[model samples]
Target: MRNRHAKDITCTILLAALAVSAATAATAQDGMGDDDGLAATDLDLSGTDLSAIDLSGTDLGGATRLKPIVVEARKFEEPIREVPFSVDALPAEEIEAARIRNTADLVGRVPNFNFADTGLSFANTLNIRGIGSSSALISPSVNYYVDGVPLPARVFDQRFMDVRSIEVLKGPQGTLFGLNSQAGAVVVATQDAVPEFGGEIGVEVGSHGERKLDASVGGAISDRVSARLSGTLYGFDGDIRNIVFDGAGNVVRDDKSVREQYSGAISAKVAAELSDGTDAVLSLRHSRSRERPTTGVWLDDPHFPRNAFAPVPETTTETTGGSLEITHDLGFATLTSLTGISHYELDLEADLLDGFIGGAQTGLPPFAFGAAGANVRRIDETSSQVSQELRLNGEIGDRGQWVAGVSGLYSDLESTTDITSLAMANGAYTGRLKKTNLAAFGEVTVPVGERLRIIGGARYTYERQQFGGTYAGRPGGAPGLAAFAESQESTFGFVTGRAGLSFDLGPELTVYGTIARGEKPGGYLFFNQFASIGIPLTEFKSSGTWSYEAGLKGSPLADWLEMSTAVFLNDTSDEQLFTFNPVAGRFDVQNADTRSYGWELTMTARPTESWHFGAAASLLHAEITSGNALIKGNDVPYAPGFTTSLFAEYRHPLEIARRAGSAFGRAEYQHVGSRQIDPANSRRLDAYNLVNLRAGWESDSFDVYGFVENVFDEGYTTSAYRAGNAAGGGGVFAGIPGSGRALGLGARVRF
Candidate 1:
């Protein structure tokens, strides 16, 4: 059945490609001049009054072209269509219309991107081409950056505000972005301070008691300085229910997995122009969020599909950071420097066992109490990072462009965990981890001819990791095992590189191919208390991947139509795999050999001035080529076999409104294929479809909009876990369900 579906999709894509080619060829053949193609005409409009002519609704037939988008995810600026990799650029207007708030909102919009909500904000995960970090302590395979400053994985869930653009770069980016970018990168650019004084404010109301407020203000403070500030606040009530009863036989009405939450962020930036053609920008931001974390519900229990027995599950996060960026231009080269520091903290408490013990103890005496039956877990963690980078960029005559840079990073992290029950206790576990990284990288691009170019880059990195921690037994346990402290350190280094060739077929077409190698450093896994006892924990070895890709991109019909397609094969060795250890009741990291091959297609068309359309699809086949028996032939977790999306928008002039305005509507459809949840491939999530609708009216100074998400109210799971002995004597399957249907209304005003 899967084969049949795959064949059908392949055939459809080929047919679409042929049709587009035919149309382009026909349009090219229909020339409007003589056979010699040297026809010319003279116009006598010297006495014509151009101001009296109305051109508001004129059909220019693709004469007025759309501006080309530039991408900066490669640490350099290049036109998106000419880049030798898969990239997606989303402008601010598109983000607003799509109602994108966080990483979770980006899935399906970009090819091969997926997100899983693990109930806790800090535990949520993102996957690109089946590569992601499963443990919170480990760096993500896909890195995220905001205005050139790297962000921690835990903060990926924060709400976006005053964003100017977002660029998604797929495949390995190690040569330019360094480690932790083995899979890809996401770059977010925010609005900068301008010399003009202006501001905007918006308010939104939605179902489930949702409310949001966002605003931004910016202006010039003096001839040499300009400043800007932006902020956002959002909150909503959850929809899940808790039906379990307490020990007093009274019904517990407190809703579980409720979204009752409040989160806000404020960012300020100041730019100064100094003498000697130099400039500097200082930025500061702070954010705080508190929410009732989602709780997992038993998959076998049909009576409470959206309900959980957990009584107390909550999480709170706080982040503060600042950065200073300076730039100077020399006669032959430009120099840039960036320095930044940030601190992040998270506190979470959840009922791990839920009601497993309560239900099992129904038929037994109430005397059973000890560490062996604990049902609750609480965690607190904090981390701080400081980073610095300096770079020089220049052009070699007229045929080449080059860049070289050096970067350094230092980070410190601390965490504490407590597990206990009413009558039993598992002593607290405390740990501290520190790391330092240094790197130097260089890249150059040279034109071989008028239509061909060659590009190459490489980076060398060195890292050192130090860990110290202690594990303690219950208060009444043996004195020898009551408490112990241990420390360990390790150092490693590696080099990664990329090489590519690109050719311009015409003014509107580009073809490119690239070969790149990406690497990610290894670190110790301290979650396993038993493994940390008596000796230093062994660090997992680093992992690497060699990727080969070929792609074609072009606007054959100019602004009327655009298309891009790419195929890639990635061979990975010592692939990092995260697995649950039932015996240890924790997660552990291991190494495996794997392979991933995939193809992606993206298209956009604006056949008419008032109508626009877009479509993107991805097909992947990723598996463990050689590994342990449990994973050797299994599919990579979280990677679907295929995914696709389609969207259309239309706008029309509104002549009956209070002032000059336009009305627009949009509809989007997305499909996500079935996916596995573990290396063993014993659990799978079924395929799901979603549809969204949005409509709005806008003018120069004001706008109003309404939207409906999950129009059909489909039910599905975003994440799942299987508990063997941890859930008592029998195994239990639990999962976090996806959000249900919702509607929202909003308005915005600008001055």
Candidate 2:
């Protein structure tokens, strides 16, 4: 392995050298620096004096810009310091260059935000302020959105392309964004089409036989219309292998698994300046993605020694959606209306237990009777949703601004399961579900004084749900129990609100305090005949208290440094808890109370024109406050007590090689604290940290780079499955090990 890695690196360096030697005559600017046309002057902000200028009202997007401005938490468009909560904003350029594959990678670097992969290629989970569920089939306490349009919770296969920026709003955001925000919200904004003609293409290859290609184009279709198109192509041979037998009963499924993904979107924008001072814009966006198979494999096994490379059956998922939005600037503020529709299909199958069930089994009765064999379990499902929202924003007085809105949504879902029950014939079941929701909300912020501002808002929401199903257990011992379920509906309503105060302590310091109430809707679950025939399960619901607080947003010691820190307390009631009943073979939801408190600190520094450093650290304490009889005050499932990340980058002028653009190097360290699989806290995962290194040279139109992940080749487990153990597996079946130290190289070009 060592020799192979060394050869790969050597080949990469040789190729890079040849490319540089062939194209060394062009003067270039990568556009990340200042556009003043001054060589290396873009980095001059470090030593410049700012005391003489009033930078209070300057639009950072234009002056010391990053990219498109984001207003996810705060309604205003000033610096992030003005908001009274923890927030992390990363733009497209940084995301692309850093090779952040998904939302998990992005939040893994931020304080107080933990995104955990579920081992499924498409579905992911998040933990914020120690408040998130670890279950793969339940709705998340956190809310997610794209372009101001809220998405259905737990729809994990959604992909992001042509994204302009991602804003993570920490803390409860129930006032404006009700239901599903008891923890927080993530907003994704995509780039819009412009009147000018421009486009870019990027391609990369990396570790684990990974390869990716992306392209985007935007321009005007006519004088009053404009359109933009973008597409992504991705393929990778997964690191894990399946070592199971094939149809020929041959020992196959070694690291031979592969995945392919494709996604595309088209956006259209229309505008016409009216006779008045008001202008309007109508925009539409549509996107879809098809994934070959999302497979999860165990890292180790006893029965199947080579099971790590087994060939699991193939599965697929498809996602398609469209959105329409219209906005008019009426001088004082803006009036916006948005409508969206989405549809998804999932065709997945897997052997829940990694080991073979029947044929040649040693101590299994089913195997003795030839009642069961290596059969696949299938979960086939489809869902559709539609939503509409109308909002108005404007200023009330010289010191006050307000926003009011209303929204409605409807959803329908159907799921079918076909299990080749080794004891019987192909048994199947079908389930159906429908849901509707309506909400109204309003918010206002007022400047109480020159140095203080007050904010408050409220929202009222109602939701309803219905379910029906039928199991193919007919003619069996259970009898013909036709699921002629009648209409069963329930209405859930809540008023969520927020209040906060912000004070400007000094020229470079600000402090704030806030209290808010967050809420989540209730919904039913569907199951097959294997589940007990008893009373219906309780719908899940959770409510919580969010107290956010203090710290500074600007450099307190020097103009070249900026820092922010905060402390928070989250007291949650009616916490949704899920428990499995072995006798019933089903999971039920109930209400409990929990308390979580934490602190976060982050720092960004640029000491010289060639160096930049940033670091963040977080600590959390979470436990169940009530329902001791049930959970026994266990720590939350996915919440880690401590996590930290540190990163540094340096750029140097290649005087020896005369490289038009400076060469750069980066290094990062990430540490995650211990976590437990069950609320009992009986089982725990040890703490571990990972190191990564990257170095590259980029020019005006092209870039070549190399990266090494898991530099120390540390091995650790991310998540464990209970189904494997239930099936009589001796070794705990864990999925997706943190890959070992691996190296790869890639290049990109844009025009």
Candidate 3:
């Protein structure tokens, strides 16, 4: 722990020195906000046409004060104060200032948002309000979207290079979005075509052979048309040290895979004014990643990647999608039509006892699996989806607003897995699934008076799904059955809704309460390892959750400090968990009832023009209320007890090449409490703390910055599961190690 103490001391000294330098500066130069005035009251909206105002730049950070912000989160543009819920909107400025490279960075910035980084970007999972599944294949409580199209898990981990805005809505958002959002939703809007010719180019290089090049170009093509094109290419060699050990349990050597992974993505879009009252936009995107996958490590020895033997598997993933949206004005109302399609593919070739499962398996010694080279695991997966929706939005003179929509979706998934490991009895599995869904949803807000409002919404959905798969059995050392193929289909119908009340104590404060129901349809999982035996294919039932929340928001300390607080309780039934089967493969699935209660706080302060602070905290308690009697009271898997983030930044003027520029130093602290990794409570991931530091200088046209993440090099694990390397290592566990200390430099230019 001495090294940890030293890191803390070093961080303290550096930050103290920077703060001192800022305070003792001879002069301070005005920044972008100097003339504009950073205060909310100082905003000047005079002479601007509210009807044509942009909603993409809305700042909904604190519900502390009610401002006339037009936000487009409910599939319709509306005043932020009237939403009567929790929503955090971060535009391009905040994205750039925070140096948020990917969706994972959003965890600390928002209360109750959690991300589990499983080393494989494509396999990460997002959770909100202490609710998440142990595996990625299950129906997610929280969903992700880009523009208006839902993103499959295979591409949800893509980098955010040309993002324009991101909006996070907490709690059940089933009525507000088109996707399967049982818990919450994250919506991302990439940079769109601008009326003027403009773009940016950026380059970044960091440790572990990290290199990135991203660029974007956009301009008006005609009086009524504009187009934009953006792309990003990045590569990272492996950082985890793979150690080879002898029978004596001693590390003998290290394996390094340098310059072995790369990824690239491109997005293109065009916007047009078809007529005086009509507009349309079309967008397309493609992304691909080819990498030597990071096999996991032992949780107790995260820094020492023992038995992460290779020839490493080469995992390749690709995603392509397109979307079109059209809007028309009908005098008293507006009509919108949207259609989208997406395709995803994954190809993985791995080893059973070595490169596939990290560290240990079945609690057996790592050296026992030295000859696992003969055991191979190969998988190929493909998925595609098509969605269409039509909605109408309107207002009632001086009363309130309303929106209604109808949407339909169709999707297909296919996968094949072959495992030659002796532990699995030399088996293979293949599966195919198809789903079709249709739904109608509506929401309305009615003003009860100048200080009070009532909001209500509901949705009715019909779903049908079909699944089929086969297991190739081997009759050998383990019991086996004849190879059999089976197919099953299921149908479901459900209704969900939300109701709320909001009272405006004044222009600066509001109190609100809401109760909503969220749900996920039940379906068949084609590849259950247990089903390979005499067990029949079992279809899980649908799940539902009722969330009740009450909160207060406002600027209690006047214009400089803004804060919000909320308390919530959730009751759920049939929550699904997909995980590794202790005896064989990774497709084990189950369900349980759960209860969770939590309180959250978010604050932002600008005590002075040169200093800024932001903080958020989420304290929660979640437990299984029922289902399996053995662990009925166990804490919900992967649901941390608490999470928090604190941030501070100081800005000062600097003389660069005889020109005035801004220099800034920023510090951030984030923490996640410990939690169980499985419903059975056989394994757990300990709490972890991280410190990140950043410093930079920038002008209006360009910026240069450097950052050090995980400055303390704290050892942690992002995920833990049953290990496959051990013979009978059921009690022992292995995990995907979290990132270590890494520093990097970056530069960007805008024209």
> What C-alpha lDDT values do all the predictions have?
0.74, 0.62, 0.74
Instruction: Give the alpha carbon lDDT tens digit for every residue of 1-751 in model 2.
Output: 5643653454355345423422321112233245433333222232111111111121222222111123546544545666667777666755664567666577666777876666564356676887766554556778778777776664643556788767778888877776578788887778876778878887778777777777887777777666677777776665544444444445443453534345555554555444354444555555554443324434444432222212254456665666777667777778777887777777766653344332222333221322124355677888898988888888756756788999988988887876654434355666777878899999888887777878888989887877676655433323333333333566778888888877777655567788888877656555443421423445566455555555455445443445778888988787666555445556566566778898888765543355555678889988877764546588876688999876666677563345477688887767788876555454566777777788988776677789998776766666544333323434343444556677888777767
Candidate 2: where is the Cα deviation over 4 Å? 1-70, 121-123, 157-159, 246-253, 258-313, 356-374, 396-399, 423-426, 474-487, 528-536, 545-548, 582-585, 628-630, 655-659, 724-733
Stretches off by above 4 angstroms in model 3 are 3-70, 243-253, 258-260, 301-303, 355-368, 371-373, 473-479, 579-587, 724-730
Q: What TM-score would every model get versus the actual structure?
A: 0.89, 0.83, 0.89
lDDT of 1 at 119: 73
What TM-score, to 2 decimals, does candidate 2 have? Answer: 0.83
Clashing residue pairs in candidate 1 are 238-259
Give the per-residue lDDT of model 3 (tens digit) for 594-678. 8888998886554445666567788988898876564688887777888977777777878799767789988887888898877
Error of 2 at 706 (Å): 1.3
* Per-model RMSD to reference: 6.4, 7.6, 5.3
For residue 450, what is the lDDT in candidate 2? 74
For candidate 3, the TM-score is 0.89
